[model samples]
Target: MGNVLGLESFYRRQLRQLLGIRHPRRISNAALYKRCNARPLRYRITKARWVLFGQVPRGSDRNPAFMQMARYFDSSTEGGW
Candidate 1:
């Protein structure tokens, strides 16, 4: 959670700098995103994470990493790592 917040803060600061928006000319985050026609950084990160997670199950079953992941998800494993 701390990492996510740090990333978001960095993203916002960069965007503000890119658009030449300085302290005197304050803008709400929503307005800044609207000006750039972009989604929040968190949304993009979450979407990417979901996409990668979806691909993991589609990986070859013979892969040892996939087998271990399958075991981790199995009911008999009781959610243990």
Candidate 2:
């Protein structure tokens, strides 16, 4: 979940910074749904993350829940990022 959010944020920020957009781009609900239905795993996990967590909370860089999520996904471990 955390990784998905991070991936989305990274892509969003890159698009905004590179394109000089003042606001985030609008997501196409229909297209997004179709993509998910067509390829659950191959499709972007960020959208799924958004559906599940609807804008994840922010605070410390080392939030415990974030760490635990990473660990569960095998992306990171106790030593932390």
Candidate 3:
């Protein structure tokens, strides 16, 4: 399973739990790489090899490989960086 910046893995954990980032021991890997404030795909997620965690957002035209299929129904899906 791989999509890189295009998001997969359950919508990248639902866009990193809508930015609060919760998973992998309730949140770890250096606290989701410092709450992803620097973004560079969260320091490339420990050099990605079938990721242990995920997220990718930096400006959005809603096409990060189809943007989670346009958020199913778009009842206010979420935000970004």
Q: Number of the top candidate by TM-score? A: 1
lDDT for each residue of candidate 3 in 6-81, tens digit (9 for 90 to 100): 5434445655677765545376434554676434453465568234223333335475634653564467756622
- Which segments of candidate 3 are over 4 A away from where they belong? 1-55, 69-81
On lDDT, the stronger of 2 and 3 is 2
Clashing pairs in model 3, backbone N/Cα/C closer than 3 A:
none
Residues 1-81, model 1: lDDT tens digits: 789889888888889999999989999989988998877878988999899788878999997868878888788756485
Best by lDDT: 1
Local distance difference test, per candidate? 0.86, 0.52, 0.50
Over 26-56, each residue of candidate 2 has an lDDT whose tens digit, in order, gives 5443444354453333255656767555333
- Lowest lDDT 10-mer window, candidate 1? 72-81
| Model 1 misplaced regions, further than 4 Å | 62-65, 76-81
TM-score of each model, paired residue for residue? 0.80, 0.28, 0.17
Better of 1 and 3 by lDDT: 1
Extract clashing residue pairs from model 1. none
